[model samples]
Target: MPRGKQTDTKLTLVSQFFYPDTSANANVLSELAVGLEERGFDVSVVTGQPAYAPNDRRDDQPRREMYKGVAVRRIFSTRFDKNESTVKRMANDVVFFLSAFLHLLFKRDEMGVLLLPTAPPFLPILGWMLSRVRGYEYVPVVLDLYPDMAVELDYLSEDGVVYRVWDQLNKRAYQAASLTVTIGETMEETLTEKYGPCETAVVHNWEDGSVIQPKEKANNEFSRKHDLVDPTTILYSGNHGMHHDLESVVEAAATLEDSREEDLQFQFIGEGGRKVTLVRMTKDRDLDSVSFLPYQPVEQLPESLTSGDIALVSMQEGVEGLCVSSKFYTAIASGQAILAIANEETEIARIVEEVNCGIRVDPKRPGQIVSAIEHWLDNPDEMRAMGERARSVFEERYEKEEAIDRYATVLRRVTT
Candidate 1:
């Protein structure tokens, strides 16, 4: 790994968040940086200060630091500000795009390869702009598709100026990049169909030494302390945004409020834009069956996950092809059964149905969710079998070791 060797190639990874950000994209890019470095690439990451996870925060740290032998350069960003409005978040993305675009321009000539794992959706444009400089091969590792996804989540209008501009830029960026990578096969297929087979690839995200499956204590301190002594626990952790329409879960909870399913509780863990309204609705209805827990630390993930009998992984009605909740992978690794809330045709639903991995309910239907929960509770053998199936699916497709090996190979092949 000597510097300036004939075979030595410097690769730069750009993202909005890095190591300390607990989001899926941040975790994926951090691992990619470390993985590529180990594979003998001169890996350098350019990211904004972490606004979400403390570990990803870089505002107080120096502009640059060596992270696990990878050189990480933090670009200035305003996302670190607390309680950002929707407008503020959009503005933050704009600022990061400009700052990151400038940084890439400055280093364009030095990098043999440039990788951006979904941070600012504007990155494809920035990457294309930087690739205009000689000697830079822009590699876009897409964690999620924008415009389409944003529209699905109601973040942007389908025909809005922003969407129209981004759509064109994204297509051009896809055409311009040396390779475009995604987190799973479904996304690979989706991107392939959309852009007509540019060098797109799949590399799922993984957990590192920083995170451990939380030990599922028979009694989670949060559950016990909060007196959530339900007969069955269905836990959903991560952002509770519009993307996570809790209406179905709420409706199911209401339907089962008078039922004797003592352990059947729905616990939501994590913060998001819709949290306030969601919580208010829950409180208004006196839904004691539902409880909210603040997201726990990585060290406590195993225990946090163990708090529930079942794990809930869901998405908005659409964007099924474009995004898979990385949280579902974590639940699988935790060896928990999943009650997937998504479209029937999605890879997630396919895995759940094909493997019988817990439950698959149209998240739009509370009655269906209630029935699924009741069925699982009434048939413990069936439920436990689904848990086993979920774990098998993880070992077969989403295991970190396998995913990282694929990524390592991609880094080499694209650069070679």
Candidate 2:
């Protein structure tokens, strides 16, 4: 609470999601909080109640709980139905945004530095307002570029009034922040161009190496349990959301169905907006080689990931700089050869090319995806070598420790 001694005060992280939640946001934030605490910084997290899974949703979680040595305070917010309308989802975001704002507003004195991410997408504006009012530094960690993403996803039109208003708010929020932290170089470039040059840092999302390491497919328990013993599995794991070009993966599966005689399977293991559509398409096409599974628990991640010979990570063409899929890092860590379907200029493409860990193909072309798969199928040795290179890159550049250290240093510098 004293001037010039910010480290003594707790650093507060504001997020709509946090520990014990299964989403990538929660998991990554948990790692960062624990790492900061280990670096001798007092940390507290202000987050919404855990309800990542369907059955886990509750009216409220305990007001406070300690998770991985980080003190967490959960705010009571409205829970929207899973089948709810977009209006309801926005309402949920609004309710949580306000709840988090008022909670942080009252407790501002106890906190030294405020760190927030774009989960609800507009919540960082609240943090910016509080920083202006209470004189504490607010750092906006941009996981996704909003208004742009909303427009790209067809949720909003670029020329619409809603989009204009949201874009203005976004600019103001970024301009007010003491520093802006985003995930990738493409995102950094986009933010700077749109928001007009703020102090930005690009710290990539990383994999928890200890939890997700390379394992032989034959030795993987998940594969054995699911009877996925065949080595010709091409896995697409993670959020099968609208931003991902998963439909093309299905198209590729259909394209190769008759040509390939091997027992090849295209496995998708996660839930998202696109998952249902992908499932229906796979069923409608009668693609027996394609399979779907619910998201596995965090403990089963390594086995589930390693079960695949090659991992398919994709992003839609126009949504390149908005957000990079975190699954790419996990795939890298799992030592599975990656076939990235993304824009060539994006960060994922750059990383895959730089590390020599994967192949990047045009997201729009299913034929290219099919060709890449067939090539890997024929040259197993080359694929294995690519996977090894991916693991090496994961260790050298995208490990949890490196990302945490970068975050910790940024937090410390801002506080000082």
**lDDT of all predictions, in order shown?**
0.75, 0.84
**For candidate 1, lDDT tens digit of each residue in 210-300?**
2444334445675565555445778888877667767778878878987764656788888777677778878988988888877677666
Tens digits of per-residue lDDT, candidate 2, 47-157, equal 887765554464467789898788889887766643346786687788889998788776767866788888788877887778777776788999999989988889899
Among all candidates shown, the one with the greatest TM-score = 2
Total backbone clashes of candidate 2, pairs 3 or more residues apart or in separate chains: 0
TM-score of 1: 0.91
In candidate 2, stretches whose alpha carbon ends up further than 4 angstroms from where it belongs are 1-9, 58-60
RMSD list, candidates in order: 2.9, 2.6
Q: List the pairs of residues colliding in candidate 2.
A: none
Global lDDT of model 2: 0.84
* Alpha-carbon shift of residue 335 in model 1 (angstroms): 1.1
Give Cα distance to truth, residue 286, candidate 2, Å: 1.2
Top-lDDT structure, candidate number: 2
